[model samples]
Target: MSHENAKQQDLARATTDERAPMSTNQGQPVGDDQNSLKAGGRGPTLLEDFLLREKLQHFDHERIPERVVHARGAAAHGFFEVYDDSLSEFTTAQVLTDPSLKTPVFVRFSTVAGSRGSADTARDVRGFAVKMYTPQGNWDLVGNNIPVFFIQDAIKFPDLIHAAKAEPHNEIPQAATAHDTFWDFISLTPEAMHMIMWVMSDRAIPRSYALMDGFGVHTFRLVNAEGVAHFVKYHWKPKHGAHSLVWDEALKLAGADPDFHRKDLWESIEAGNCPEWELAVQIFDEATAAQFDFDILDATKIVPEDLVPLRRVGRMVLDRNPDNFFAETEQVAFMTTNIVPGMDFTEDPLLQGRNFSYLDTQLSRLGSPNFSELPINRPLACVANHQRDAHMRHTINKGRVAYAPASLDGHDPAATGAADGFHSHAVALEGRKLRERSPSFADHYGQAKLFWNSQTAVERAHIAKALSFELSKVATREVRVRMLDHLQQINPVLAAQVGRALGETAGDSAAAVPPSAASDKADEIAIFASAVSPTSASGRLQSTRGLSLLDGSQPASAAGRKVAVLAAPGSDASQILSLRSALSCAGAQAMVVGPHLGPLTGEIAAMATFANSSSVLFDAVFVPGGAPGVQQLTEIGEARRFLDEAYRHGKPIGVLAEGRALLAATQLGTLSGLTATAASGSSGSPAATLEAQGVLIADGSDVATAVDRFVATLARHRFPDRPLAAQIAA
Candidate 1:
């Protein structure tokens, strides 16, 4: 049977309802689920109570050993469809080249260093692992949010992970790399500088999983029917555009809502606002690659778009949230070696190491080589393997002939020719057994500087602040100085700003009063500085497309954004309804937040209460006009705090006629005074003086006009550099 039919059959067998009658593991109906069978309902449980025994046994083994890395993650079920058959020219992989095929896929997004209980908003690399049950077989495109990795070779992966994780001696910090040990490792590894710039930038703190880009960090080979091979790098460009949260917002979210990213994904999918990304490929040949200054096999570099542009080939849309978190999301396994016929691995050391590591990890954590038999990990294609299962073996082999090419079974399961089966690309290989890295992978600072130069001014500022904050957390002064020395090689201005923030100089060991100690410190800095060449291909390219989240080409749609509409008992009924409807029409969720829950006025009800909600939860705020409502809102301390906090965070606020009084009364308004208002007309009518200041104001009589302006302003997201925003109290 075809993979599509297999997928349909699997979906049909999956449980659709959780309200079914309760039963034991053996499907025996249970009469009592609240209490276990006991001697007299208050005595020790009877040994004959199979239901109690089964339940307790299952509960005892419910928790599996979590993954060493990427322990915390959110997953979804989706389908991938190619845009056209143009990709077929490069590879024969049906999933990437067949426009008519709807390949079922499961994607998991995760943080690299965090444990199972870490905060979702922590600054770290995000894992973007996609498992596609293709027609031929399963293909797992395991990748991360960043295009480059910290190290060039996979041999250092353990060391890198060890240093980034909690200190082994004390296990002091969890899910963060700000401590001294992490810096100590990073300061010594010059190859880590390129990736360090990324982890310390805003990209580490994404606004939502839906808004970040995903990359296949290593270059792989795409083989066509003609046996021609091309080097390819895979990219997943978010359809909504790559965006990230402000540093302050990310920090607050970690404390206020630890599951912020996971919740955002689940709620958006449930609400029918599915997230999407376009699959793009940068395909090049050996000749083209030879002209590049850096090696394609290096994991610490990226092939800039300016050199080889990305070709948009397909799109993946995640429309369904997982039915069961543990059964589906947690149990699903992704292996780098699970590739189809037309795709083959490159000689990239990191890639080769991952090809082995991922499978080993699954075997260790899933507790069996038969992990592939699990429903979530099972392939949609038919299985005809001769090998039998080990632990957790669910499959029952009917025939006695387990071995292949048996005369007794008429050699029925004989292998097919190369053309009819999966084949690795035939490439000439030459190398002696060695433990040294290639010279081409030596230049690390070039790409580090390139990433720094590609960011917008505000983005660069955030990067500097992040570096300062992380380094400041390191108790060791030498670690901070060493990191600064590397940063100086990447960007002197950035290094200077971070050094000033830390109140220390890059190469100055003034605190080391002893001459010999200071000389030793200076020598270490010089060694790090000499390791990486500053002028390379990546640096010469200047800036590239798709690096900055605030670029002008990014989408300005308000779809999927959450807006908080603050209302009170006396809020204008028409104004409230009109604003909510307008926001809904824009595909944004406008939730009514009031002093209390339930009914607020005629035909108006509150969905969230001030005591239980904060402005940080929403993207923007809208206050409807009414004399009594404005008075009530101003009297509530939470309401004032919400407005003030929102303003301080640079969120746009819209106030109508009487509602304008509430804004003027807040501490935020006092800093800049209530701005001027414009004459009201229709939605098209603008010229509101306060609109320039990111505050849309209108007379109570023109509620429709004001709401239109407000929704429009909300679509633009936060207005960061407005004059009023500048005056708000920090």
Candidate 2:
């Protein structure tokens, strides 16, 4: 079999027993599996009920230990293919340079702090771990959605997770980091300021797993066939561009639907809307690294895109959902040490520690050194090794010799020479074994300020509001004040905004602290104080590229977006059907929502109801024209709130003919995008009107024109600048 079919064949063999007759582990026929072996109906169960004991025992031990972090996850099966062989000059990794090969991959997306049962929409880091089954071996690129981390060294990883997790004394807040313990830790760790800015920004609450970017967070090395190495950073850019949920939508989604992200991924794949991302890398040599002021080894820092642009290497598409969640997604294991010959580890302290910790963690979680034997984790490459069996061992080695260099077996499994086997890059090193951090990692506020300065005005306001909201949850006043001091170092204006929200002034005695006390050292600041200036030392745009979500460089598409069409009894079925057909042709789903489930009209049926679904769940709202239906909708409270809430959240809304009555009945006064004219007196064909503010209105005859204009507005996602002075509470 070819490399592509090898793993599929193994999985087929393992799952062949599915849908067979029910049986015990020993393959005995199970006639009464549901009731178990029992005594008389009125009497106590017999002690000889072996079937009952077996079922209960298996059920009790079914669940393995969830991960210490990133326990909540969803996964898919996919394939990764390179765009061309352009990267071959920099690395001998065939996975990145082989355009003809489609390497099989399994990707798991997750939230960092949540447990197995936590909601998927928490404001936290998202894990984007990928395991590629290559011809040479499996390569696991375990990363997060954000480009940076809260701490620089892996030694402080435990402390970071402990502080971010729920408080231990009472376990008060479930998956949130807004409590006192988290802010207390963050207030003291000055080095975490850069990552803090990212976490508190809109990037923390992604709109969807398929709409966010992924980063490897640490620098590594790419070695070519000649043993030459170059420092590299890995990135995964979504094909449709990165987007995020507003804070209000994220909070409402947590209570309304905990599995929002997981459902979205599964449905998208089933609907033939596969999620795609381009695998890009930032490649540079040692000379380039030395020219930078900040340390590339620091995990909390980012190498700005303007400094080193990304080179698109390959593309990955997730087209298949898992068959069994436990057998595949939950049991899959990924380790950072699983690299091929072309890739080697850098001296990044955090990466070095992770290379050791990942392997150790699997030993405890999977309960065996034989986790590699599992079908999901198994590589397509042939296995010929001297290692013997352990717990859960699936392989049966032949012959009497289990040790290497054996004479009895005629040295059958000898090692390949360096030319064909894995080789680490040879780099000269001279350093004392000390516990001190490099001085290059000291200037943390420079990048924090860079991020704050890169945002658009609206994005900046959102970040300020997020910081105020998170800090307001902390009960300890000192922790909030200390954080304000650190923020003052990053940007005084930001500090003042958050302080005003907290009912304190930024430079007050309770919050003011010397610059030296706020940072590692007062002199360290002078090293990179000009880093965030409009122009860098290289005369490049220093703060704008690849930082903001609304940069307009990212492409927009209408695929996979959902729109809700409101309907009621005696609704205009023809208008609804025409609009639905137009949206369907544009690759968007149009769901008819009514006051209750079932038929809303003779030809139209409600797929969703106002009571079960909220405005926050859809990308936009549409109201069809029908005097009776519009009157009925005007009497419904949910129908009225639906329009009000959609307008308040800046979502696009479309109304037709009599449907304008329902839109007008809401408290949204003087809609900016309304374009109305008398249907009978209009001389020319009525055309849909769309303003910069995302709202559309049209007569009943212009369904096609209205849909085209409405989709264009939906592609823009939202209008954050819409005037909300007349907005009413939903």
Candidate 3:
């Protein structure tokens, strides 16, 4: 359609909708919404204009206070059901054991320190909290991407948060740990070593929430039908395979698209590719817990998956996105105490504190005791409770006898019996009133070393480079030294490598955070570090089966991916036809790039046209052997920018004919694997050239092969070992 016709259509649609007229609050008709009531159009408006005042007043208060932590979160609504009612042997939670039951669930995924406005691609711990509304009650499994936490004790949470957030003096850096304050705190707290190593690794910056693995950071108790108490940890394995963006890619994505993660999620759901996760648990008896080297209650550690494999219990699939982001996603509350009968809490200090903290925080933030009455927070089960009346109370009480014990009032809602009621496991407490860190919680380096050992070489290199980049940004020498010391405690080589990356020496590391001390349960440390091969790449991922991302999720295909085909105003007609058909057969979306978004007036015309889309928007690019159009591509900055951006984004490129010559002339053509060969026909144009498998050059302008190769490259997202150094030198 022409621009003029499009504008006319828009005007006509606007005119059709105008019949209803625009109205304001209180049913008042507005003469204008674009401009306020001004004294003389452009002059200052009078304060007496009530409509403008109301509009501005409402607009000013449009945003509510964001969460103090995890303010940035993406939410989805879903339903969960157990694979079997076999859990009856474990607990009396009817929902867990009832095969006919289906529970409603709301899940929120977030970044810890970032504000709601922060970049989605920042290197930070991701929060994965799920609210399961069961027949018994609401149960919230609040967790993080990494299994461990920064601090052992809950008392230091405030200080830890403050350091991780912006500096107190200026509050300059937002949602990032690349500052002096964070390093200073981490250097001071040895317990924080394990978590620090993780955040510096690739796991912290996952490709999407769909690809991240979530863990309930604290160990909890799962009581069976026989009232047998077992210590357990919950985990959510993504139905999509685990994957992460490169650190360099993440950084660029932050600037290029701050809403990258959010948009990806929204689009995925809109495309009917719903996200899913499998709920699993690591169960161990009380006797088993007593056998571990480190304290199971310590939040800053994980019972390695090898110790207890995840036993799948249920599956949660988020097939629907919320209708309203605020009411459903934002207002939905998750409380640690909202567990069913079968599930019970543990004395993991941080978990205990969080159970208390979440309710208080929600009370202050939501301004209500009745927050559970909110539609999103409300359970699918019948809610019969005595708790009522504070902040927007939506419920109506029936009886005049509000007090419990009454002769006439039959509705005395107290505990009926232990059979159907929420029951706590009969575990005795024997601790005296005292404040101290457990001797078992002090072994910080053991698991830190284990995590380091588990990583692949690429993962380790990424971590080392990340540490160097983050520490290098720390202007304070002492802070850098402190971080260096922590890294040294993790691994000497890691520390030394980062030191070289940051141009520092180990001797200068700030006095080893109150001086490293020995742990009481040092024997526990030995168990984790025993006879483990550190260099094995197979163990780094969840599975050794190819580490293929196409697993768990959809199959490999580039049907919807846009492919750019470069041809001139006067290129081969039959070539375009055969090439387009081949690409179309491959399920790729092809667009012809000629002089402009204009038609390709070549010999055999086709349905080929262009839009204003840059190369950055496409999955791959193809430069058909059109030497005539090569000048148009190179001369145009947007066109060249297309090639450059694609290179940086790591998309595939295919060039042929004089197209290769044009690439060689410009910076884009000299990229790795761009080897030129002779064209098949006697056109004297080079075509049968091997660029990269991703970047293909056909045998004498065999457009079909270039299209086939483009599809293949899209399948392989990136080429990590590209000979970029050689290409740059050329």
- Tell me the tens digit of each residue's lDDT in model 3 across 1-730: 9997676555533321447655667876665555566789579988888878888898996676778899998888788888897767777777667768778888999888988989998999999999888877788888888888999888899999999998879976998999988888888899988888789887888877776788898999878777787888888877744566777667766776777777766765666666778888888887777876678999988887666777888888876788889887788788888888777888889988887899988897788888888898887778865676777899997776655544455654563554856678897889889999878887888788777776655456667778888888888988887777777777766776677667776654323312221121132123222344533464432212222232234244554345776666555555566666876665455677655555664653323433344554345776666555665566665555556555655567766565665455545455432333443443322222324425555544456665566666665654433334223321
The models' CA-based lDDT, in order, is 0.82, 0.83, 0.70
TM-score of each: 0.90, 0.91, 0.78
| Count of clashes in candidate 1 | 0
Which tens-of-lDDT digit does each residue in 1-730 have in candidate 1? Answer: 9997677665434441685666667886766565677898479989998878888999999999999999999999999999889878888999988899999999999998989999999899999999999998999999999999999888899999999999999986898999998899999999999899899888898878998899999999999989899999999998877777777777778888899999999999999999999999999999999998789999999998878998998999999999899999999999999999889999999999998898899999999999999999999988877779689899998777887567675665465655746788998989999889898988989778778777765567668778988998999998898998898788765676677668886555333233342234343233222222324555566567667666565777677788888889888888888877888888788888998899998888999999888887888888887778878998898888777777766677888778877877777667654533433444443324446757776676777777887877777776654444434454
Candidate 2, residues 129-209, lDDT tens digits: the string is: 999999889999999999898888889888988999999999878889999999999998999999999998889998889
For candidate 1, list the clashing residue pairs, or say none: none
Worst 10 residues of 1 by lDDT: 523-532
Look at candidate 2 and tell me the lDDT of residue 463.
78
Given candidate 1, what's the lDDT at residue 66?
A: 97
Q: Highest TM-score, which number?
A: 2
- Candidate 2 local distance difference test against the native: 0.83
Q: Give the runs in model 1 whose Cα sits over 4 Å from its true position.
A: 1-20, 41-43, 412-418, 507-539, 675-690, 700-702, 722-727
- The candidate that wins on lDDT is 2
